[model samples]
Target chain A: MQVTKREFLVATAALALASGMRSAQAATAINYWHHFASQSEMAGLMKIIELFGKSHPGIGVTQESIPNSEYMAKVSSAVVAGGRPDTGMVVAERFADLTAMGALVDISERVKGWKGKANFPENRWTGMSQDGAIYAVPAYAFVDWMYYRKDYFEEAGLAGPPKTFDEFLIACRKLTNPAKGRYAFGMRGGAGAFKYVIDVMEAFGSPIVKDGQAAIDKAAAVEAITFYSNLFVKEKVVPPSAPNDSYRQIMEGFRTGQTAMVWHHTGSLIEISAALKAGEQFSTAPMPAGPKAHIARVAYAGNGIMKDDHVDAAWDWISFWGEKDAAIALLEATGYFPASTAALDDERIKSNPIYQAASQTLDFGRLPNRFVGAAGWSESVVNPSFQSVLTGQLTPEQAVDRMIEGLEAALR
Target chain B: MKSVLHRGPLAKLGDLSETRYWVYLLLFPSLILLLLVVAYPTLYGFVISVREMRLTRPGLNGWVGTKHYVAMLSDRVFWISLKNTAIWVTAAIALEVAMGFVAAVALNRNVPGTKLFGVLILLPYFLPNVVAGHMWALLLDPRLGVINDILVKVRILSSYKAWFADPATAMAATIVVEAWHGFPFFALLFLAGLKGIPEDLYKAAAVDGAGPIRQFRLITVPMLRTVITAAVILRVISLVNSPDLLLVLTGGGPGNATQVLSLYAFQTAYREFNFGYAGALAVVMFVILMVFATLYIRLTRVSKD
Candidate 1:
């Protein structure tokens, strides 16, 4: 049979298109939305993605990084507007809000069947679960700890880091020297200030939420607010900027020697290490004990399915983060503690004295408050209330009353 | 050579253009676009405001007429935000206009380096609000800010000041930063309006024995009235709607000292996940802007002119 050149070209194009479509169909592409904005966090995420690609050749993962502050905004919009990603990063504090909004899919069945689930303890899953249904696979942890300047401590004739709040106050007074333009603590009283405020309240034996209701011990909370605010208002140890010092300000304060100490999580270890020398210049310690009890948060950040359209592929990708290699890779790059029991035993984590504080915290650290309206109550109420105390707009008693009123409203 | 023409859809459209139906055809795309982009979202916002559309508490999703609005009546934050919004908008506008007028007149002088000065003046407007906020935050930082260092060296300050941390100073500091960023918008528009005014008018004023200030009052101000009205309205709308800079610098902090209506609305929607309440707040803002625009135009008599 005779064929025209045009017909031959058309047939060739058809064949190519068919082949491309087949190839595309064979690979299941899943989109992941996360808020890992830091350079090191991105590096760790890329490492995990690279490893996941190698392990699951048939599944393709694409990631979208949202700024941590705007993560919930973006996710909520996605949920309401109907363009949800297949999977997303879920922090302990935001899990309730995310689940309440129905942004995360129920992964309890998948989690139960997975072999890698054995690595995680029941407490690890507690943050990511609601009403006995797991929503995410635990990836890494942000174990709370204190970063203190060793040089400043030694200069002040302090033998070691403070173990209790009373000792911490003494050290704050000793380490602070206004003549040298140095402060004692980098109090994060600005955005995300709610975390420390809640912690302080809990440390003073105030229950934030009990049985999904506001259960704060008013006296304890009042006392907690007074003590925390005193570091800035009364003691004059924290910088004047403490009322507006968030993560960046606090980190800058500690790294530049403007302040003697800061309270942050293990996630900041890599960033701090980049600026200051470990052991000699600065060192890590578990957060100081409060009056009634010690409180440190081991906030487990994990990944959950946002949409179940590509359920199998999404499941595989999130589950991979629970494995030892991914956790270790993340820890190496970002200094985030591993949520998996197996990854905790890695030589890199075990050998580093810098990680000792985080290791100790793993034993006693409490998970962040996880209830509906918890985010709202903390951010809208606790943050501003605490700041009011620091700025002398409201006394500790008034602030506590305000917080109690706000919490009740939130629970209602 | 002879040219050959083909009759097709293009020819058909050309024929259709001559008909009365052509105007409707041209208007059709824009009509659909307006409905989709502007009308639909606005109506939806109104609907949401009257309903219980909390994303987290979906179980409570139902029509709850005037509930959010009623709640706003007694909301302490809402009242504080309202007062702050008035101060933020009014103070920022006054500063922006004064600075912008000075800048516009300076650039209009046609002096040497005016082009470079124009570009320099417009640089702040070119920056995103988020970037500008961060830059200003660092500049006013208590410890390492260059501004603080200079202030101390010049004896303007005994020590560094935490601008955003102090409730007394936070609102004022943010206003100054906003004015710096937004004045360029007025400068550009006013400069354009100045260029269009006849130089003969100024010459006549000068001949009539008007001094520089008198001539400016009589000629420049009168001529730029329309531009001034347009610029004020646009800037007010923009200032009222955006919450980015405040979100970056303060997140409405030091006990909601810097909180404005827009920022409060944003926190209500995103942080609290109370979209219904947010929608009500937005509706209030929308009404406020509408009333302000109407009153402003009436008071200035821009339409009469």
Candidate 2:
């Protein structure tokens, strides 16, 4: 059964030729990981993938959706264990942590030469960049806004959504009717509740990071806490479950007519639309102004290359998100605001009355606090401290003091 | 006999297999696998607990002996979590054991419809923690909970209650849900043990006029002691280590009222990227579990041959 040298050489050559042909014909597979688990988000992602595939036949994109709650945990573990995807979705709050962990690749040079670069505003790029290196391409924005029952306001003899906090409180009191099991506000005090707490604190003129340092004005924070928690504690205009209501609970409260208003971002518009009428039963409004300022977070969620193996394809996919077709497709499906200002001119977004609040928000909305440990500090410290005040376990001053101490510890 | 034993290949092979070192030779692969799969990761976790290994902040990554421990000692959240974890584990275990024991006894009677009743009792355990947690969360929801509706309709309450939102009832509510999920483990084990018990003993006790309660206390209790100890230990370890139920139901909240050590450790690790502190919390949990297991086995005399 011994083979001759010439015969073996001939067989080897044939195998090599066959392998080379297969390799040449194979499409380049690039994986994209994201935390878009909703039906509409998945639909939007599928549309984007379909468009990308049609446009680039030689490149294959594999999309993986991780649950938002476990997205960072998976990303970090992947980075440590060396199984990172080619690209990953990045939100503004996680940009710093993701980059610091070396899970994101710097693509400043590519971004600099990108043709769609000008479509996004400078602030969007700022949210996507750190240390003079762009880590992600801004894809969509989550413009924070308040959704209220238009009919409820009308029935309460109110003209429209209040423009300031004092009027907002009055409206809350007027709309609340315990006999009907209706509360004024559905306060998000659970998992994703930290965002509104920070917004309110900032509204009271207590900047979390002032001059690149942790400089929370304790007195202002205390005042903010009192004002926010008083809606539950003193005013009694909030649900008893306010201290534990998260995104789902608060949204459910608003949709089911258990509450008059709920504060959330534009990302929830499609979901709310599915449950109630947009222009009649429910309406969106710019967040009410506080004594010092009006705070609305325009959080940009983007895409960044997580590994270097498929940098070109990764860049292609990320940059595609900014294109008008892709942005409009996503906005139509999920109602996520496009980060590209150019795409904002679409007739659907401009002509729709429901998106007026988002348009108003974009005028003055700012990015969320972007710094290392912001996530941990926000969810772990700020959320619970505020909840403690709401539950009457701690006074407003005590909760603010706790937040300050925890913030200092987190920074250190 | 001498001719047969004259260094044949088969004889020598048999002798080689009989040697004491051959046993170790056969065990080498399994021992290596154990070290790789179990021992290495455990040792790594311990080493991480003693360092400042933040995943995001690589510049701060280095050895920091006992720094995490010292920080944890003064951490107010840690203290609150420790207290909550103690109560959560203890109360949940007691409720689960009591319910499981009762359910097992009822099923062991071998009455009509026992099989269907058994299946119904075990249904909750088949659901994953996340599913069960969500189901209970919706059931006890303040805005639209069927439980509250029924209770109010039945005149048990005047109004709806946010079971998981209020500190007064958060832990208790979570414990009830956990007990429902975990009691089946004990019932399954106990049911098996109950079947293994002889009918003769019960007959003799009954003939002697030792009623059902007295017979269960004297015979069944003594017979099931080993199974009871093992089940309680396993359930306690499980309840203390897994915080998914509380995470979903309360997020350890209405102000950390239900914040268990595991949830705190999880938040510290994933949310904060502070693996050092998380590892320390984990090591503390590991030590507590170890001490409990050891003391429990010793006190129960389950190791006696």
Candidate 3:
């Protein structure tokens, strides 16, 4: 059919006007990618999303959960291949790598102007910052603590959790009974074992990185490795599976009464609580101190804008995680400690006796090692080097040498 | 073909199919697709191997002639990984072929429960690599594994054994898991080959007073050589390239005891963000695989047949 020029122009103008009106009325849809795969974590995320929906009805948020192990892989792929989410979860360990790959946008300006920023102190921002520019809004904290079987501790005549590494070793001797399938500690030596390895080194007065270079104290690191590996290799207080036992195995060992104690963070409280009765079956304690120092990591996990396509909506969603209601909701559902001091003051957190260990850790806990190559070095070099020690393939001195060499290579 | 309309805009195109250029025109789409999907990525990978392409340190990315390859010459882990890869591939192939042959021969008899047995034999293959890895991990778990429980009950062991934790047993455990998951691939192919063999040949052998085993060796081996060669090549390529099973079960550790080339390359690329080194690793893998396939085919004399 033939059409006149004036008629076609009129129709095109009408369609454009309709399209403009519809777009003006549409809600800003922003996508969030996170690594919260646990049922409790998902519930907490959904709770915050619900609260967000109520508070900001004009902005719509969609969430995607990636497994923690594969999160960085997927994020890097997205950055290189070009299908980035509006916002993503950022952990302290991944901050440097993420920024180096340009996976996250600089949100320093938005953070400076955020009203809820006051709730987070300087330390909370230290992990998510590089060169005085913040990339994420601190949402919650992963406070390192220990979960011990209370009944077993009582049976072994231990009055309370050990206060130092020496006491911890003595407790290990008393608590272990292999004939009954009981071990003192559930050691994590698999995929994420590097975190504890680094922490132990620091507790023995070995700095990982200082002045933007490899600063590991070889002697102190060797001492730390010897002490830690001895629990499995020489002391035989840990299970035979310590070399390959990761988070799931360790948790199972603690809950099933195979292990008397396991080191983890407060994030796993709800999972353990679901499996065992608090105080009667299990209790929490701060990580025992080493001879040279007491080291416990208080890693602040937060959200950041990955792509600024929907910058305003993404900022709104991430910043809302720092609000009191959002933080409290997450804590109530998942037992993740709130980064916001205002949320930490909530009665639900303060009234719980189980959270006392986490509260104590907050007083003196240090941030994780945050160099550009931290993840690669920890996972690739530190994990294997320590595992070699556990399996008796390398002496403590050799392992320390390997770690020093690897750290130097990484920093270079 | 339609006649050309000289007065319209489509005049030249309407007569195109009538010319010699039509052949090139028909091949043009396929050639474009091949270049886009295959040639481009392959050339890109080769280019990446000779250059620095780290995702984390983008500033340092540039042309670096043979730096990664030179560094790999003295890399202990790379050498260890190469040795382990050889052992892994050889061991897994041996187990898979043995298991698959037995299954295929047993199924060819067509017994009363052959169909059910066939399905059961293929069940492990139906599971994805990730699922099968996790399943085996739980079944062999030191703390609460059913295998450990049974072994203890049967007095086969004094206590539970951590299969994947101990370096001595980690590689063997992963090999067993790989064999279980991959055996069915060979079984299916071999079963089809068995069906295609002439029944008259067996009859003739029986008439000539040859026993079952001798007849089978003489008839079956020669007849299935082509199928066996093809199956082994495909399975080897898959086993060499795919790292998901090992990634899930071991992550190439208990201190590099289970480390293989593919897993090493993957960790280098993703975890370290050192794509240049990973690309170099990939190039090495490609060369090794090409050499293996060529030598294997020649040694077997499958092409002469």
Inter-residue clash pairs, candidate 3: none
**On residues A1-412, what C-alpha lDDT tens digit does candidate 3 reach at each position?**
9999999999999999999987775648888999999988999999999999999999889999998989998998899889999999999989999999999899998888889988888999999999899999999999999999999999988999998999999999999999999999999999899999989999999999998799999999999999999999999999999999899999999988899999999999999999999989999999999999999999999999998888999999999999999998999899999999999998888989999999999999999888888899999999999999999899999999989999898887
Per-residue lDDT of model 1, residues B174-227, tens digit only: 999999999999999999999999999989988989999998888899999999
Off-target runs (Cα >4 Å) in candidate 1 are: A1-27, B1-22
Q: What is the TM-score of candidate 3?
A: 0.95
Better of 2 and 3 by DockQ: 3
lDDT of 1 at A178: 87
Query: Judged by lDDT relative to the true structure, which candidate is superior, 1 or 2?
Result: 1
DockQ of 2: 0.75
Candidate that beats the other on lDDT, 1 or 3, i.e. the better one: 1
- Model 2: residue A245 alpha-carbon error in angstroms: 0.1
Deviation (Å) of A94 in candidate 2: 0.9
- lDDT winner between candidates 2 and 3: 3
Q: Which parts of model 3 are misplaced by more than 4 Å? A: A1-27, B1-24
Scored on chain A only, each candidate's TM-score is: 0.96, 0.94, 0.94
Model 2 CA RMSD to the hidden true structure, in angstroms: 3.6
